[model samples]
Target: MTTIPRISLSGTNYEIGYSHGSSLKAQIARQIEFYYGMFQYSSKLDREGVHSRARDYEATILKLVPNLHQEIVGIAEGAEVDVLDIVALNVRSEIALGEFQDGCTSLSWKVTGEDGKTVQYLAQNWDWVRPVQQNLALVEIQQAEKPTIKMVTEAGIIGKIGYNSASVGVLLNALRAPPTDTTKLPVHVLLRLCLESRTAAEALSQIEKYGAASAQHILLADLSGAQCLELSPIKHHYIYPNSDNFLAHTNHPIENIAIMEPSQFPGSKERLERTYKLVETMSSKNISTKQLREMIFADGENGNFGICAPEDMCKPKWFRTMTLFNIVTCLKDGEPTAEVVFYNGSTDWIDPQNVVTL
Candidate 1:
């Protein structure tokens, strides 16, 4: 029910990291500690091996995005934690899924009002360990020439989900497929790239250029339009909105037509079905922001089948899956203005105006 902390960083990437670490040292430490425990509990690998694997990821990330690498190193020096720990947090999806499984739901739509003006909206619930709530931080990054970016992320992670000054927003959901080389770009990094993009098409190109290390579903929205991207280590797919101008996706792959391997998260289909049915009931025109919030927070029968996921429903307590936060962004045309509502385990939403001017 409390407000999530916010941190602002500007200047070069290294300077940004230094500023982030200096401002949020304690929260960053807590984040690293929590992930270490979660990794140990969920995986068969020992602590030493896990740290080594993190170092391997560090190498891969640096090769993929050297700027992010410098930022992470600066953060490590300022926060006084091992650089590998930060790398582990950035790639936590890959490491955690080595043994544990989790889920998330994303939905986006365009509604036309009676006046004929259309409003674009995207909303999602980031389901993860309840304990991660303590590490949650809203980060605003300002660079020299690149687009200014804002994201809600864990303390040590560079990005998870957020929009940018270009009015481009991204929502992420985990997808399960056969594992590939851990050397490819991680999915979280791809999410960051999407935020850095100026247009939805550019974001899709970024995913195609780098390719994802694991399976993932990325929903990208901008003033122009929105698109859903399905990516695995080896293949990729694109899905457009249905006739209703509505799109909903959970953890599983639903658009795959070619013969391929089965998904590891079969339960995702049920969650997707629930979301689709709920979205179908709403009016295609004039779907207000209030209605979007209600849909994201709605619970199914006995809290069993809805967008909001409870802790008890997460099987094998060690996985720690729960709805950590819900984000709803309304993009306005002709300017970089967006109305964002960030709900952090509370009925009240954080006002974007209060946090950042953009």
Candidate 2:
């Protein structure tokens, strides 16, 4: 079975990070190299420039979530890399802004069972440059006084797409926009903060208070329902599921207020519309996790820019992006059930052995 490495971590924030770094030292180094190259190619920034931006983001992280800052410090110590390198990894989205077009399709489905129980499912197809897929790690974090978090992130990044024991799950869609706020929490850090919250409301409240550093869309869902937080440096908006009880998002900004560059990924609109149509047709029936996976894996509508992007689909092969993984979290009564399918160079293949349940 082809699978991504899964690391289980428990203890203080620093200890969790230390374990992550020590266990995945080589992967972290690879992530740094990948991002450094991406920084230069996408944002035209050198390593020194990237480090300078990372230092500014570091101050914001310290002020907002000092514990996470300590975790980052511990990661650097355990990995034997400079703290700035990890910091740069965490804030790579902010530094690059809209230059690197990493496309994704995210959705949240809320349905009520015949027994009057409500269940919410949050899922996404994480598309990115193929090389970084090797560095992906499924990290399970057990912290004191916070929800247990199971997330998939690049080796050095402290925060990313994941859910918690509190039944809150978040899916990310990177928006290609400018004007990042250095004083505010970076988008990835905000994702970690949301995972720490016990409820969706608490996550939204915390995000509003800390503010967002970049323009991105976070599709946040709980057992109750879900809301898409369309966040930018200057403004933010919340988009809930439709009357049919589901919402979908892609790389483009849904709201017109924010200034965003034209998406380099061509099929954001096509994918978003296609996802809506897929769910609408299934509204009369039960939506299973397997069904959701099928919907996410549907391809060829826009060829290379389809929902399940293929590497050869993009011209100038260096810019090719492919789905690295598809994670679906179903939040019900006792616990939230989640599964991740780590891509193995095929769009529609979902081997049972490749699925990791959390």
Candidate 3:
């Protein structure tokens, strides 16, 4: 593959969604196919069942964020697919539950510079099955009232891993434990809401208000600082950076919350530990983006299941997960100082990969 498609969208919510859907119609179909296969293999849920769950989420989103709902509608119309299909893609986390596991490591580091300014960074390795790798898209949305969003998401899904013009960024890790409540907004929709916010606090408020449909870990950071929201269907928890001024999250929950479904990915714990161990070697106050990149690219004994997961052919299709892409965003203290880097291609950090800087 050359590089992931980079799409720039600007207009009303429906127009933006229409552009996204029409521009990526083929990729969106492929995304639907991939998710359908995963749903069947992981949870025994057919397309009908997935759409059934999606309908409830559609109603909830329409009730809560109507403009976003319009966007979803536009996507369906533009893609020439049912609206529920896009909704199914958006709410895949809640629908899959613990049956389908996604392995991702998220990190946030905040350092006080010599000039009494704070240098904050948010980064993640988006790990998933290999088949969907080619379906991923880098989407930038320019909305009317909300801040502009630049996110890397699966073709049909609107909300995902990305940062906004306001310096508010979000990283997602799907949790295994869950009692999914279809009455609330799904995690992906909540992610879009967070990205629309001007600050991390506003994002938190949105989560608290709409609540989550299932369990998810959302690592949120802004110009001020960073905080991890460990959201369960019923209750939520927060994880802050340690005294070292750095925080890392894997697939497991750091707080003492009830886990209904045991995690299938055993390497989550190891990856979290490994990330911390790697951070130990870097200076907290002077951590550079290069150091952060090295941290995500650290692949060793946990090859098939490391922080940078590599696909294992021996494993079943659903179990074959690898790092799809990596994104790192830095919010500094000056004009035009904000930095966003996206890495796509081979896991080898030394390889000549497609790197995009914005």
Largest lDDT belongs to which candidate? 2
Deviation from native of the Cα of residue 228 in model 3, angstroms: 1.0
- Please list the C-alpha lDDT of all candidates, in the order they appear: 0.74, 0.84, 0.80
Worst 10 residues of 3 by lDDT: 335-344
**Residue by residue across 209-266, what tens digits does model 2's lDDT show?**
9999988899998877899999988889888888878889998888747746654447
**Candidate 1 local accuracy as lDDT?**
0.74
Give the better candidate number (1 or 3) by lDDT.
Answer: 3
On residues 266-333, what C-alpha lDDT tens digit does candidate 3 reach at each position?
78889888888887776666565666666555455578678776676787887677777777777765
User: Which has the higher TM-score value, candidate number 1 or candidate number 3?
Assistant: 3
Error of 3 at 294 (Å): 1.9
TM-scores vs. true structure, each candidate: 0.89, 0.95, 0.93
lDDT of 2: 0.84
Which candidate should be chosen as best, given TM-score against the real structure?
2
- Please say which candidate is ahead in lDDT: 1 or 2: 2
Tens-place lDDT digits, model 1, residues 256-345: 533143545635777788777777677787766556656544443325334665665446656757677667667666444433344344
Clashes of 1: 0
Worst lDDT 10-window in candidate 2:
310-319
Count of clashing residue pairs in every prediction: 0, 0, 0
lDDT of 3 at 330: 77
